[model samples]
Target chain A: MKARVYVTLKPSVFDPQGKTITDALQSIGYAGVEDVRQGKYFELELATTTPEATRSMAADIADKLLANPVIESYRVEVV
Target chain B: MRFGIVVFPGSNCDHDAYHAAKHVLGQEAELLWHKDRDLKGSDCIILPGGFAHGDYLRTGAIARFSPIMQSVKEFAAAGGPVLGICNGFQVLLEAGFLPGAMLRNRSVRFQCEHVFVRVEQTDTPFTLACTRGQVLKIPIAHGEGNYFAAPGVIEQLERERRVIFRYVNASAEAVESANPNGSIAAIGGICNEERNVVALMPHPERACELALGSSDGLVIFESVIQAIRSGRCAATLRHAQGRPEPSRGASPPAAALVQ
Candidate 1:
């Protein structure tokens, strides 16, 4: 089974990297890009398992390793 | 007093911390390897600055699970004093020794420079020798040094006087310009509710010697040493104070009293 995890800074927290990218895009004539929020994506290869188990395991891994709950929130997708 | 410096693989400031604790402060200090399982009966533990475990997912995330960290966790749980500096501070947060988290500096770049930090609370094991509002010159070197916590958590920390240090200007006002990393409340350091474990973004170990621009860092090392010598830290404090909590909020700073 394959799964993906997406981790992003909590909305309440500032993302200066995303803001800088937004500035660079605007400078390069991509003004239509009003804003950019940066995040991390992780692909995991797991042993074949039930869908429920896979999701639970992925969430557990994301919570413990892939993402920091303090400053980041994560989404798990079974791909 | 024995000071234990935990040396993670990428820890570059381990020697600096040992020098500050041993030769400078005249206290016994030793380097504890990350793979080791024992602290050798150290009275205080130091998590020095550096990119531990390469700071891959997040600073201190990987290092938090190391073998030696387990021992440190137990040590801290027993009311032992632990001080984390810079990356060490990040690890302490990840390990749950301290609350909150670090964010990329607001400037979006790694910064290394000397800044003034005001001692906000002096009741902790790390700041007992410092007078509240006294400014210390310390160098901070890190990309993700901005300290962040939920608004409610920030309020609780403030109310408890757990905010041990705050970035400040030469005049001792915590203005925005003086903040190098945009830390919340201009926080440079903080202690746990127990007031035994403390973590700070600035490198106090680097400023212990006069040749290194300032000896302000000595006050922190001295604070802990004196605390241990006078049996004023952690376990002793827990019983002597005879209160459910330890905070000097109602009492004015020693300097303020003189003024």
Candidate 2:
């Protein structure tokens, strides 16, 4: 199975890279931008045998590899 | 006193911390690799400062899952003394062993320079060797050193006296301007409520020798030694009574007398 994981900093946390990008976009004449929050997306190909197993396995990957529980939250989508 | 320093793939200050333990305190210290499961019977463990795993994805985001971290977490849970400096501090936060998180500097820059820190509370093994309000000069070099927690969390930390150090300018024998990173309320370091684990942005081991331009960091290690010996004694006593190794979630009463 193939899966995609999206990891983002919690809403209450600050995102400097996102802010910088937002500023650059504004300077380049892009308007109507309110805020930007940076995040990481991971594409994973796994052969976990079963779909039910894939969900548990994906959650494990999220906790162990894809995200840091303290600041970043992650979601996984199976393909 | 046996001490161990964990070496992650990109860690830069592991040797500095090991040398501080060996040269300053004249004690033998070991370096444990990130993939190693054994801590090797060390009384204390340290996660040194550096851009571990390149601080990718997040400051210490990847390193938190290293094999050695599981052992480190077990060590801390077993009432062993643990200290994390700078990037190590970030790893501790990512590991959920410490409260709060590290964000980019308020100015959005990777700050690297000498900074002053005031000892806010000494009820922990890390700061018990220093007098309350004492100031020390140490260097900080990190992109994500600013400490962040919700206002309610900050108030709880204050009420519990968990704040360990705050940035200050103690160079002129006075607390001057703030340091390289603009941390929340100028915080440079903090200890868990149990006070056995400490995480700080400043590199104390880097400042332990005069050739390093300061020896202020020596006392920090000394405090750990004192706490370990005392804790071992308590652990032994508690073991005799068949009690679960006294909780590591609060400061030992004797810690208050350390200062």
Candidate 3:
């Protein structure tokens, strides 16, 4: 099974990269964009036989390694 | 006292730390490889700056799982003194030894320059040699050096006076403009409740030599050495001094103090 982990900075934390992207977008006449927040995505290929097990393992990885709980939150999607 | 400088695969500043400890401070120092489980009975352990484990997945995230970090964690749990500088600071945070995380600089660009940091608390083993409110001119080089923590954690650190250093101006004012990386509270460094574990964004080891433009960073190294030589745990030195009065007299520049 395969899993995808989405990690994002907490809403309250400032995202400098996102802000710079927003500025570049505005400069390029993409005025409809109000703001941008950056994040990370990780795809893991698991050898588990069941989707349930893959999801659980993915969540564990996200919590323990993929995301820093202090500044980031993560979601796991098993596919 | 003996110092151990942990050298991870990508660690570039391990030699600088070793040189600072062994040559500059005239103390015994060794480079401990990341794979080594033993710390060789070091009095203090340092995690020097570099893109450990190539900073993959996140800075310090992968390096935190190295074989030696297990020993480092155990050492810290036993109240051993640990100083994490720059990338080492990130590793400490990632390994759950410290209370915060690093974010990219506010400018979203790599910044390498000399900045002033004021000693906020003088009780830690890392800052015992520094006077309270003394500003040290140190060089910081990083792209992801902005420090962040939960508001409650920040409050607790403030209330307990665990904050060791704050970005400040030449006049020692910690204003927003003086903050180089947009860290919360302008925090440049902090210590744990026991005050043995410290994490900072600046490169104190690099600034230890006079040729490095400033020797301000030596005070921190000297402070650790002094604490170890006093035959007391760094945390207890404050109580040993009768409730920890701040050092008096105007703070001298690092050049003058070192000479």
Clashes of 1: 0
Model 1: residue B1 alpha-carbon error in angstroms: 1.2
TM-score of each: 0.92, 0.83, 0.91
Q: Which 10-residue window of candidate 2 chain B scores lowest in summed lDDT?
A: B233-242
Give all candidates' CA lDDT scores.
Answer: 0.87, 0.80, 0.88
Which docking category, incorrect, acceptable, medium or high, applies to candidate 1? medium
Q: What does candidate 2 score on TM?
A: 0.83
What C-alpha lDDT does candidate 3 achieve relative to the native structure? 0.88
Sort by TM-score, top down from the best: 1, 3, 2
For candidate 1, lDDT tens digit of each residue in B71-180? 88877776778999998999999988889999889999999999999999989878989998999999999999989999999999999999999999999998999999
Measured by DockQ, the strongest candidate is 3
Worst 10 residues of 1 chain B by lDDT: B249-258
DockQ each candidate and list the results: 0.77, 0.42, 0.87
Candidate 2 per-residue C-alpha lDDT over B11-58 given as tens digits, one digit per residue, 9 for 90 to 100: 999999999999888776999999998887667889999888988777
Second chain TM-score per prediction? 0.89, 0.87, 0.89
Q: List the residue pairs that clash in candidate 3.
A: none
